[model samples]
Target chain A: MTLVESLSTGTGFWNPLAWLIAVLVAAVIVYLIRQRGESGYKKGTTQTVPFISGNPEPEKEMVHVRASNLYWGYLDALKGYYNFIVPAHTGVLNDYVLWYLGTTAALFVVVVFI
Target chain B: MFWNLPFIAVVALSLIGLATIVIKKNLIKIFLGITIFESAVNLFLISLGYRAGGIAPIFTSAPSTDMVLATPQALTLTSIVIGVATSALLLSFAVIIWKKYGTINTDEIRRLRE
Candidate 1:
């Protein structure tokens, strides 16, 4: 098999060995730095507890970060876009199929006409 | 009449799949719709290379009649494998969603939205 060659039509070339070497070098640097860092973790101490604005920590389940709660700031900033987009997602299976059919029909019409 | 049969079946199968996807609320039903859609696509591809009485491309004896094109079959095989993987991944995600949210209803699972 022809391996590690540039595309016949493109100028870009990729070599697997080069990528492997680069990744290894980067990993070694990260490993060395991590080894040198202070490992001051102590069990059964206040240091082990997560600090939450000086307030007593809530129960583990209560404090668990749910997937939906993530990226709050980003979502808030894009509230206008999400308002239009989120409702369309509806998590409805039929809606998803409708979107696909609509797109396919649109493409068919476009291809036939133009 | 017979020549257009597969093409008609392809369109019907895909339309049925799309309808199923749109009308179904259960996650498993939606996945089944996806599988049906994939089957329709694979059928369409295989039909594209159909010959009235074509022989397999593999040769072990003297040269004979024209063989059906192999590329589309290869592509359909690859697509089938990918579809299996995608369906498995989607079902696993469904399981995870049920575990985390205690329900599989898309509307009820909208914890990410404000």
Candidate 2:
């Protein structure tokens, strides 16, 4: 009812006013931290180039990250789960349909019986 | 329950349509499923207007005035028109996708495909 109070969503509440204040506070904190960033590195020099784990940097042309490699760490951490899930995504059309129907039937059974 | 057979058919058709969309990889099949879903909706609208032994909503019938509601029929007509447009657009997109990708499998259309 009030501007500062959360609006009830029946299952949850959201307060735009509170979120706005939080965002403003976070922005101020970020600005302060940015002010502390070291400007010791010379611009338009070798110092501007990215350091590769204390090794010589590769060619600037090959500096880009591949799309699949972007999530390498996350995928490695969840390798066990991904092992089952990723292989299950066989490019075959029929298998995907089977999965969809299987999930729907399972949910229907659960909803009806439980 | 026998009297509500059309309503049951509507539910079944809707579920089938949804299953087709989720399970099928062929873009054309997905469009067909969309059409089926739209038909199910149209069937639902038509069924909702039905009265026991009711004749068509033509006032000029000269029979008893116990006729099915006409508003839902009009709504069904509008729905069919929209469905036709949607199917056309969907098929056109499917054609374009096939031409560009050379395959219709959804798995092959993945963004991270190396």
Task: Output the number of the DockQ-best candidate.
Answer: 1
Alpha-carbon DockQ of candidate 1:
0.24
Candidate 1 per-residue lDDT over residues A1-114, each given as its tens digit:
567553454667677777888999999999999999999998999998789889998988997899989999999999999899868766555566678879989999999999
Give residue B57's lDDT in candidate 1 (0 to 100).
Answer: 78
The residue-by-residue lDDT of candidate 2 on A41-101, one tens digit each, is 6779978777777898788668887797788889899999988888776765556667877
Question: For candidate 2 chain B, which ten residues in a row score worst on lDDT?
Answer: B105-114
Pairs in steric clash, model 2: A97-B23
- List model 1 lDDT by residue over B7-76, tens digit each: 9999999988878787877777888988999999999999987777678777675277566668988999
lDDT score at residue A112, model 1, on the 0-100 scale: 100
In model 2, the Cα lDDT at residue A45 comes to: 92
Question: Candidate 1 regions off by >4 Å?
Answer: A1-93, A103-114, B61-66
Per TM-score, the best of the predicted structures is 1
